[model samples]
Target chain A: MTLLTSAVAAIVCTIIWYKNAPKNDMKIGILCWMYWGATIMWFVDAIFEYAELKAEYFSPAPADMLNDFFLGLSVVVFGLIIWLVILLIKDPKGVIKSALSKKAN
Target chain B: MACFLISTAEAVVTTVAAKQIEKNENLREVNVSEVKYSHKTPFSKKLKWLRNMLWGGSALLLFEHVWHGEIVPFFPFLTAASNPADAAEMLHEMATVGVTMALLVTGVWGVIVGITTAMEKKAEKEDAAQIAEHAEN
Candidate 1:
């Protein structure tokens, strides 16, 4: 549920960025990549849950799969957060300027 | 950008339809000043009406899904329950969190759409007024 909630948050942020930002802005591309990365994490989490449900058929243990999935996803989401933060910090004025210019036209 | 393009297209179609209807009615030079204002109705009142109509519809649909037990199978935690009453209680608990997240997503999207639409309308009105002034000159 936490994973899905975070994914929902990312989706909302993406939609807001798309609607308000400049058309075809490079930042949108970055945001989209981040969204897809998060989505992958969500799917991985779901798969782990499903595996746990069918533990009789699976041999290697659900705990291992869950741990690996969580570690991978956490790393990916962390990296995306860093990237997004750096983007927001660097050239913040330029982002607004481009968006405003597109709006004006 | 896709949403903006679609909105602009809709605006164009609306304006064209309005012009055609006005022509058919044989109205000459429709004036904004001719519109009447009611003291009892305020802009906020109209906005509240619109918000209720739109957001209320969405909320009803979401609640319907909850009532029907449609969202239960999606979460693995809820699937462990066998009894209907227990499942309902579990779903009710999960729904508090799920609905809150969904509302957050939808609310943000609505605000973005509203702002974008408002900006587009302002630009279109400015453009139309400019054209009218040029024609007069």
Candidate 2:
């Protein structure tokens, strides 16, 4: 379930970035590749994690691991989002502005 | 927060130095100058790169956690004992997310660079055309 959510989020974000990319900008394509690559890796990792968790079903380790993982991931994602926002804000000449301006036009 | 602050400071310094050079080139119509500034020093460059890597790595680690159903807290704000399997999963998610975020940032940066390049080219072409017209006249 967690994997599905993360995959969905990643795909959605990628699509959003792609659809909004400027006509002349090639970076959006790169972003698409990166997002998809990360998503694939996440899926693989999740499978392995699940298998290991199952093996340790009798222990509380699984639950503890799950909590820590979520907390850490959340922080990272939030941080990334913040960084993106800051970059856009600091550099109006950035891709986000270009994309938005082009859209406006 | 500390990491963000440090990275932001580094970014600001780098951007300022680069932007200054860009501005000088645009305004003076002079050849580019190469000066060894602190911001452009090897140590500074390495620090900037390391910051980027750490951020990207963290994102990937987060994703691994999300994938393994560890995204939600098990104890609901309570700290629990460590579990290697869970920890491994979490680490993977973090690293995955970190990488993904880094890629996204790079893509955005590329777009910005492209835009700037286009603008510069357009300006240069315009100047050349004007000069040609003046010569013909």
Say which candidate scores most in DockQ: 2
Q: List candidate 1 segments past 4 Å from native.
A: A1-105, B1-79, B82-89
For all candidates in order, the CA lDDT equals: 0.46, 0.47
Across B65-85, the per-residue lDDT of candidate 2 in tens digits comes to 444444455643112115656
Model 1 TM = 0.32
TM-score of chain B of each: 0.37, 0.43
State the lDDT of candidate 1 residue by residue for B35-132, as single tens digits.
54322233333333233222222322233233335435464423326567766765554454334433443354457557766776777778778879
Q: What lDDT score goes with residue A25 in model 1?
A: 36
Backbone clash total, candidate 1: 0
- Rounded to one decimal, what is candidate 2's iRMSD? 8.0
Across residues A1-105, which tens digit of lDDT does each residue of candidate 1 receive? 334544664576568767877654344444443443334333443554566578653444677656545544453455356556656666455976687799999
Tell me the deviation in Å of residue A53 in model 2: 5.2
